[model samples]
Target: MAKAIMVQGTMSNAGKSLIVAGLCRIFKQDGYRVAPFKAQNMALNSFITKEGLEMGRAQVVQAEAAGIEPSVLMNPVLLKPTNDTRSQVIINGEVSGNMSAKEYYLKKRDIVPEIQKAYQKLDSLYDIIVIEGAGSPAEINLKENDIVNMHMAKLAKAPVLLAGDIDRGGVFASLAGTMMLFDDSERAMVKGILINKFRGDKTILQPGLDMLEELIHVPAIGVIPYLSVDIDDEDSLTERFEKKGAVGMIDIAVIRLPRISNFTDFNVLEYMPGVTLRYVKTVEELRQPDLIILPGTKNTMEDLLWIRQNGLEASILKHAALGTPIFGVCGGYQMLGTELSDPYGVEAGGTISGMGLLPAKTIFEKEKTRTRVKGRFHSQITGLLSELSGIELEGYEIHMGQTRPIDHQIACLAVLDEISGQQSEEYAGMCDHHIYGSYIHGIFDGEGAAQALVSALLKAKGLDCEEISSVNMRDYKEQQYDLLAKGIRENIDMDQVYQILEKGV
Candidate 1:
C-alpha cells in the first residue's frame, strides 16, 4: 500500500484542489510516483478519458502536474449537477443515472465500494497519493453520510492537513470552529494546519497562527502566500468570469451561459499577447470585437432561452450579420444551428430555436458522444480564420446531442482521422462563411491552432502578428506547475509533510 496525505478545506473553494496539485508536482520532482484522488467531484467541468469515459477535470489537472496520463481511477464518482437539487451521477467514468440530492444521500453507502476500489488501484500503482476533500467536514447536518472529508481520510489511513483561507476572512474562527465540530476520532486524524491565500507578510500573521495552533492543538504547517498561477479551476465559481474587459488590439467576447461548461476551451487564448478574451453575460457587456464566441453549456436549450430572454441572442445575431467572425464549440456549436430539438428529455424535452448563425440543426439524444479525436481543419476553410486551413488539431468530445447540416451549402469544418484509437474518416462540425463551429473541446489547445487563429484575428484588425506571441498550452501549463511547486516548497514545510505521510492516522 502507498503512503497517503489528505488536504481538507475549511470551506468550499478553500484551495484544496490546487494544494493537492502542487504537492503532486513536488513529489514527482522529488523522484516519487504520485497521483491525486477525489472520492467524488461535483462540477460541470469534465474531461473524457482515452477510453471514451468522462471524469472531473480537477483530477485531470493534477494528473498533468504529476506528469501522468489521467485515468478514471483518480476520480471514481462524478456528479454533474442538472439543477440545484439534481445531478447526473457517473461512476467509474460511466453514467449511472440522474438522482436528486436526497436520493443520492440515501444511496451514498453503495458508492463506498467504488471509491475503495479506485483508491486501492491508485495505492498499488503510486508511491504516494495526494487526496483532496470537497467542502468542509464540519457540516453537522451532512456528516451522517460523509464520504469525502474525514471519511475519505480514514478510509485511506491518511493524516489530514486542514487548510483555511485567510483571504476570505475569519481564518482563525473557521479553523477553530471546524475543529470544535469534529468528533474526537476525527480530530485525532488531523496532523497539521495550513493558512492559505495570505496576501500579507507572514511576520504579521505569526501571532494569529500561534493562537490557532493553541486552540486546535494542531501544528501550523505554513502560511501560503496568494499566488497568481495560470491554471483552470474545476467549477463555475472560478474568478475568471468576473474579469472586466481589457482594451486589447483584438477583443474576443464569449457568451457567458448560466450553465456554461468547459470554458477552459478558450483559456489558451488568454495567453496570446494582444488578445483579450472576455465573458459577457449581458447585452451591454457584449462590445464590438474581432471575434465572438459561444462557449459550451451543460444545458444548451435552457441557456439559449436565457440568451433570448436577456437580449444577448439579438446582440449576437446583430454581430453575426456584420461578419464579426463567430466561433463555437460543443453545446455552443449547437446554439449556432437553425434549431435544437430535445425529444428524449436529455435536456429540456422540447424544441428551441437557435442563434441561426450557421446552417446546422441539432437533436438531443440520450446517448452521449465521448471520444478523443485527431483531425485537421479543412484545407479551404473560409473567412478571417482561413489561416487555420490544413492545421492539425487533437481534442476530445463530450456531448449529449448530434448536429447535422440543414442545407447542402454548409461545409464540413474538419475530418476526424482517428477516434478513441479507431481509424475512421468521419465528417465533424460545420463552417458557414465567417461562422465556425466544432464539437471538439480544447480545439485550440493543439500546436499552432491558437497561434493561427490569433494571427488571423490580428491580421483582420490590421495589426502585425509578429508584434504578439503565444506558447503551446502544454508547455505553458508545465511552467505554471513549476511555479506552484516552487511556491509550495518555499513556504510549506516539506519535511513535516513527509513525516505526516509516514505517520498516518
Candidate 2:
C-alpha cells in the first residue's frame, strides 16, 4: 500500500483540489510515483479517459501534474447532477443509474466496498496517493453516511490536512468550528491545518493564525497565497463564471447553460492573447461578439428549454441571423439542430424543437459515445471560417446522442477517427455558413484549430491578422503545474507534511 495524505476542506471551494494537485506535482518532482484519489466526487466537470471511462476533471488535472496517465481508479464514484434533486451516478467509470439525493444517501453505504477496491488498486500502483475530500467534513447531519471525509481517512489510514478559505473571511472561526464538530478520534485524524487563498501580508495574519492553532490544537502549517492559475474547477462555485475582463479585439461569448458540463473545453481559447472569452447566462448579458459558443450540458433538452423560456434562444437566433459565428459542443451541438427526440426519457420523453441554426437532427441514445479522436479539418468550409481548413485537431467525445445532417449541402467540419488507427468517415459535426455544431469537446485545445479560428474571427472583424506563434496546450499546462508546485513549496511546510504521512493517526 502507498503512503497517503488527504486534503479536506472546511467548506467547498477552499482550494483543496489545487493543494492536492500542487502536492502531486511536488512529489513527482522529488521522484516519487504519486497519484490523486477521490473516493466520491459530485461534479458536472468530467473527462473521458483514453479507455472511454468517465472521471472527474479535477483528478485528471492532478494526474497530469503527477506526470501519470489518468485512471478510473483515481476517481471511483462520479455524480453528475441532472437537476436540483437527481444526479446520474457513475461507479467505476460506468453509469450505475440516476438517483435522487435521498435514494443516493440511503444507498451510499453499499458503495464503500467499491471505493475501497479502487483505492487499493491505486495504492498498489503508486508510491503516494494524495486524496481529495468533497465539500466539507463538518456536515454533522451527513457525516454518519460519509465515505469521503473522516470515514475515508480511517479507511485509507491517511493523515488529513484541513484547509480553510481565508479569502471568504472568518478563516479562524471556520477552522475552529469545523474542528469542534468532529469527535476526538475524528479530530485526531487531521494532522495539520492550512489557510488557503490568503491575499494580504502573512505578518498581519499571524495573530489570527496563532489563535486558530491554539483553539483547534492543530498547527497552522501554511498560508497559501491566492494564485491566479488557469486550471479546471470542479463545480458551480468556480470563479471563472463570475470573472469579467475587458473585451479584447476578438470577443467570444459562451452561453452558460444551467446544467453546463465540460466547460473547460474553452479554457485554451481563454488563454489566447487578444481574445476575451466570457460566459453569459441571460439574454440581456448576450453581447455582439465575433463568435458565440454553446457549451456542453448534462441535460440537453432541459437546458434547451431553459434557453427558450429565458428568451436566450431568440437572442441566439437573432445573432445567427446577423452572421455571427456560432459554434456548439456536445449537448450544445444537439440543441443547435432542427429537432431533438428523447425516446428513452434521457432528458424528457418527448421531442423538442431546436434552434434550427444548423441543418441537423439529434436522437438521444442509451449508450454514451466516449473516445479520443485525431483528425484534420474538412477540405471545405463556409463563410469567414475558410481559414480553418486543413488544421489538425485532437480531442475526445463524451455525449449521449448522435447528430446527423438533414441535407447534403451541410458540410462536415472534420474527418475524425479513433487514435488506434480506425478510420471514421462519420460526419462528426455540421457547418452551414457561419453556424457550426460539433459533438467533440476540447477541440480548441490544439494550437492549429484555436489559432485558425481566432485568425478567422480577426479577419471577419476587418482587423490585421498577424501570424502568431502557436502555443502547445500540453506544454502550457506543464508550466502551470510547475508554477503551482513552486507556490505550494514556498508556502507550505513539506517537512511537516511528510512527518504526518509517516506517523499516521
Candidate 3:
C-alpha cells in the first residue's frame, strides 16, 4: 500500500496540475518512488502510452516530473469533449463510448471500481501516490456523484490540500465559500489550503493568510508565486494561444482551429532563439510569415468547414501558391488533402473537398490510430526542404483518418512502432514541393527535425543560416521539472506536507 495526498482546486485552471507535478518531482528528488494519479480528467490534450493506451497529457507531464514512464493507470478516466454537450469517455485507456453530461453524471458512480483498481495498481508499485482532482469540489449539484474530489480523497484515505487561485481574484471568498459548502467530514479531509498564482510581497499577504486560516480552521500552507515554466498544459485554458510576439528573425504562424488539440507540438519552436511562434485565428492575422502551420484538431470536418467559411482556407492557398512554406499535422494533415470522406460518420458524414495543398485523400475510420513511433525523414525530399532529409524524429499518432497520397507526392517519413518493434517503410507523412503534411503529433519535438526546418526556412528567405545548438527535448523537460521542484520547495512547507501524508485520513 502507498501513502497518498490529494490536490483539490477551488475551480478549473486553478494550477492543480502543475502543483501536483511539482510535488511529484519533489518526492522523486527526496528518493521516494512517487507516482501521479487522477481518477478522472476532462481535457482534449491527451497522450498515447507505449502500450497504445490513451491517457491525459497532464498526467504524462507529471509522470515525467516524477522521472517515470507514463501509464494509462495514472489517468483511469478521460473525457474528451467533441462538442458543447457530448464527450467521448475513455475508461482504463480504452474508449467506452460517447455520453452526454446528464448520461455521464448519472453513470459516473458505476466507474468507481475501475478507479479504485487503477489507484491500487499504482499504490502497489510506488511509495507515494500524489492524486489530482478535476475542476472544483464545490460544485454542489455535481458533488453527490463526484469521484474526483473529496469523495476520491475518502476512497484513497488521503488528506487533501485545497488550492485557491488568488490570481483570478477573491481568493479569500473562493476558499472560504468552498470550505463552507463542504460537510463536516469533507472539511475534515482538507489538511491545508494553498493560495496559488500570487504575485506580490509575502508580508502584505500574511494578514490575509492568517485571517483565512482562522476563518476555515485549516492551516495556510503556502502562497506560490506566479511561475512561468514552459510545460504542457491540460486544456483550452492554456495561455499559449494568446501570445502574439512581434515577427523576429524567423516567424512561424500556426492556424488556431476551433477544436485544436495537441497544440503543444509547437512549444519547442517557441523556445528557439530568434524565432517567434504565434497562433492566428483570423485570416487577417495570417500575415506574410516565413512558415505557416495547420495544427491538430478534434473535429476535422467541422474545423475545415470553419476554415473555409472564415476565408482562412483561401488565404492559406494564396500563401502556399506564393511559395510560403506550409505544414500540417494530424487533423490539419487531413484538411490539407484533396478530399476528406467521413463514410463512417466519424465527424460529419459525407465527402468534402479539402485545401488541395497535398495530392492526398483522407478517409475517416471508426477505430482511431494511437501509437508511439520513431523514424527519420526520407532521403528523397523535394525543393527547399531537401535539407530536412535524414533528420531523425520521434512522436505519436492519435487520429481517426488515414491519408493516401497520389503518385506524384513523395512519402516524407519511414516510421517504426516503439512498442511492437514493427518497422514500417514510408508509413507516415507526405511532402509536395513546399507543402508538408504528417500524422505525427510531436514532429517538431526532436532537435534535428526542428533545426533542419528552421535552417531550411532561413535559406528560403535568403538569410544567414547559422548552425544553432541542438536542444534535446527530453533534457529540456527534465530541466523544467527540476525548476518546478525548486520553486515548490522554496515556497511551500515540505515538512508539513510530509506530516500530512504520514498521518493520512
Candidate 4:
C-alpha cells in the first residue's frame, strides 16, 4: 500500500482543502506519484470531471495540483444541500437520491465499502495519497458515524496532521479542545499539528505553540501564513465577496443570493487587473456599478423570494431602468424570466414569481442537464457586437430549469445544441434592455468572452478601459501552492512531518 497522510482541520474553513492541494503539488514536484482523496464532501459546489463524473470541485483542484486527472475515486461520496432539511446524495459521482440529514447520517455506514474501494484504488496507483477530512473531527455528535475524519484515517492506516486556524483566534482552544474530544485510540492517529493562516510575527506564537505541543503530545509541524490565492472554496461560508481597493477603472457588482451556487465563476475577475468585482448581499449595498451580475443559485425560487424580501428585486429593477447592464448565469438566468415554475418540485417545492427582467418563462424539469456546452458569441449589436463576433466560449451546464424567450430576437445569443448549428436568442441577448442570462457557468474563463462582456459594459457606461485577458487558473493555483510550500519549508518541521509520512498509522 502507498504511504498516506490525512489533513484534518480543527473546524470547517480552516484551510484544509487548500493545504492538501499545496501538499499534493509539493509531493508531485518531489517526483512522487500523488493523488488527493476525500472520503466525503457536502457542498452545493461541484464539478464534472473529464470523464463526465460529478465530484466536489475542491478535490478536483487538488487532483490538478497532483498532476492527475480528476476521477470519482478522488471524492467517493458527495452531498449537495438542496434545502435546510434535504440533501441530494451522489455516490461515486452519480446522484443516488435525496435524503434528509438524519436519514443520511443513519445510512452512512452502508457507504463505507464504497469509500474503502476508492481508497484502495488510489493507493494502488499513487506513491502517496493526500487525504482531506471534512469540517472538524471533534464534533461529538457526529463522531459515531464519522467516515470522513478519523474513520477514514484508520481505514487507510494513515497518520494525521491536525490543522488549526490561528487567524480566527482561539487557536489554542481549537487545537487543545479538538485533542481533548478525541478518544484515546483515535487521538493516537494524530502524529503532529500544523498552524495555518498566521498573519504576522511568528515569534509571538511560540508560547501557544509550545503549549499545544505539550498538551496534544504532537510536534508542531508548520505555521503557515495567510496567503492570498484566488482558488475557489468548497462551501459558501468561506466565499470571498468583497475585494479591498477593487474599485478599479470599471466596477461590477455580483448579487450574492442566499443559496448561491457558482460564485467561484467570478473568482477569475478578482485577479483581472482592470476590473473590480464586488458581491452585493443587500439592496442598500447595491450601487450604480458599471455592470450587475446575478450569479447561479441552487434554489432559484427561494432566492428570488429572498431578493424580493431583501429589497434586491426593486434595486435590480431600478438599476436596469437606468440602462445598467445586467447578466445572469444558470439559476440567475431563470430569475430573469417573467415567471419561474417548479411544478414538479425538482429544486424546491412550488412556483414563485421572478424579477421579470426578460420576456421568458422558466420551468424546472425532472431530468438535470449536466454537460459541457460550446457556443459562439453573437454579433447582433453590429456596431459594438461586431468586435465580439466569432468569439468562442466553452462551459459546463448543470441546471434543471429551462427558459423560453418570448421574443425571437432575444434568443440569438445561444445555440443549445451547437452540433446542430441551430441558433436561439434565449441562449444569448434576450432583449435590448441590456439584460442577458445563460445556463452556462465558468463562461469568463475564455479571454474573448471576458473581454467582450467587460467591453460592452464599459461602453454602455461610457467608461474607457483596456481589454484584459481572463485568468489562467492552473498557473495561478501552481503559483499559490509554490508560495505555500515555501512558507511551510521555512516554518515547518519538515523532518518530523516526513517521518510521520514514512511511518504507517
Predicted model with the maximum TM-score: 1
Candidate 2 per-residue lDDT, tens place, 1-505, comes to 7999999999998999999999999999999999999999989989888888999999999999999999999999999999888999999999998899999999999999999999999989999999999898999899999999999999999999999999999888888999999999988898899999999889999998888878888998998999877777877788889978788989999999999998989988877779888999987788788888999999999999999999999999999999898999999999999999999987776898899988888999898777878887788977778888877778888878899888978788887855524677555787889888787788887667788888889887788768544668998999999999999999999999989988977
TM-score for candidate 2, please give it: 0.98
> What TM-score, computed on C-alpha atoms, does each candidate reach?
0.99, 0.98, 0.98, 0.93
What is residue 136's positional error in candidate 3, in angstroms?
A: 0.9
Residues 331-432, model 4: lDDT tens digits: 888898888888888876677777888888889887776766667666453433334555776667787777887765553555443422334333543544
- Model 2: ten consecutive residues of lowest lDDT: 418-427
Model 1: per-residue Cα lDDT over 135-223, one tens digit each: 89899999989899999999999999999999999999999999999999999999999999999778989998888888889999888
Clashes of each: 0, 0, 0, 8
Give lDDT for model 1.
0.91
Cα lDDT listed for each candidate: 0.91, 0.89, 0.89, 0.80
- Among all windows of 10 consecutive residues in model 1, the one with the lowest summed lDDT is 466-475
Which portions of model 3 miss their true places by more than 4 Å? 408-420
Which ten residues in a row are the worst by lDDT in model 3?
412-421
